[model samples]
Target: MSGAFMGPPWQMDWVDTARAARDSLPRRVRDLIDAVRAELVTVEDPYFRGVDNLPDLPEGCRISPLLSTVPSGLHVCHFDHGRGWIHYTFLRRTADPQIVVEEVFWQ
Candidate 1:
């Protein structure tokens, strides 16, 4: 957030909106989001979740790629709150085709 890009790592501007939307969701939906996200990160590969090895991603709760390039992995996140898809551009720091996940614990 300190940098000019002001996002995860790719500097996608919509990152702020994404977080805000998540924060404002109902408790039930927010909990569902946590559960789904937990499954996603545990999986080996997120970009190509094969039909055989797909996560428990529900409708209106999927993350799709908008742009995938070196040093930049852009994605479109959707949160269905009955209105429509609240889309936001997001990304993570990756080395080549491999995504680097950094674990953080909060009490």
Candidate 2:
């Protein structure tokens, strides 16, 4: 994988699935969730703290930056289940830095 200093914060857009979750969540919680989601999509190498009992995702599952690290040019799109559950999937890259490839979400 390529290496570089963590750049500015980026906003990961709410994928259709995530948007549905945001819409169903409590207002206060939704705001925080949306903010975090946006941050993950826009930046490269965003900071993430670890979460307890996090499930083992599939080979190409998307995860939160708060729970995982995203490398430059790679990104995970969010999908909300409207039950306080969120899921993500790896998206194909468009332009350079358009996706989050590496993650420090456990750090």
Candidate 3:
């Protein structure tokens, strides 16, 4: 998300992680995530579920890093609509590693 990157303390690790994650995803999923990330950048309020909603995430979901240095704070999200599941992993900071998902499947 562009907005997430702009303003305040800029974190270079996020950019690096986002780029690497983008490159690692399957083509179709990668495209979807690109659009979502762009939307998140422009829209003031992006759709996001809290850790508590991890069980409701769509299926086919996977976790991609968005910040290497703060691995538990930023992530690119993917969901599988058929299964109603979502998957993501982010770092709260360099010290905190968090994994939030609606299901246990990740590939």
Best by lDDT: 1
Model 3, 1-107: lDDT tens digits are: 33333321212223444455556767866555544444433332233444543322223544445555654454555554432222344333333222332222225
Off by over 4 Å in 1: 1-14, 58-63, 67-73, 76-107
Scanning candidate 3 in windows of ten residues, the lowest lDDT window is 5-14
Rank list by lDDT: 1, 2, 3
Each model's lDDT: 0.45, 0.41, 0.40
How well is each residue in 1-107 modelled by candidate 1, as lDDT tens digits? 33342222122132455556666777766676566455455555555545687667666555566555621344443444333243332233442222322221111
What TM-score does candidate 2 reach?
Answer: 0.37
Query: Model 2, 1-107: lDDT tens per residue?
Result: 45543344442444565465457666655564555556555434333314653333322234443333434223333433322334343343333333322321110
The candidate with the higher TM-score, 2 or 3, is 2
TM-score of 3: 0.35
RMSD of 3: 9.9
TM-score of each: 0.47, 0.37, 0.35
**Candidate 1 weakest lDDT stretch, 10 residues:** 98-107
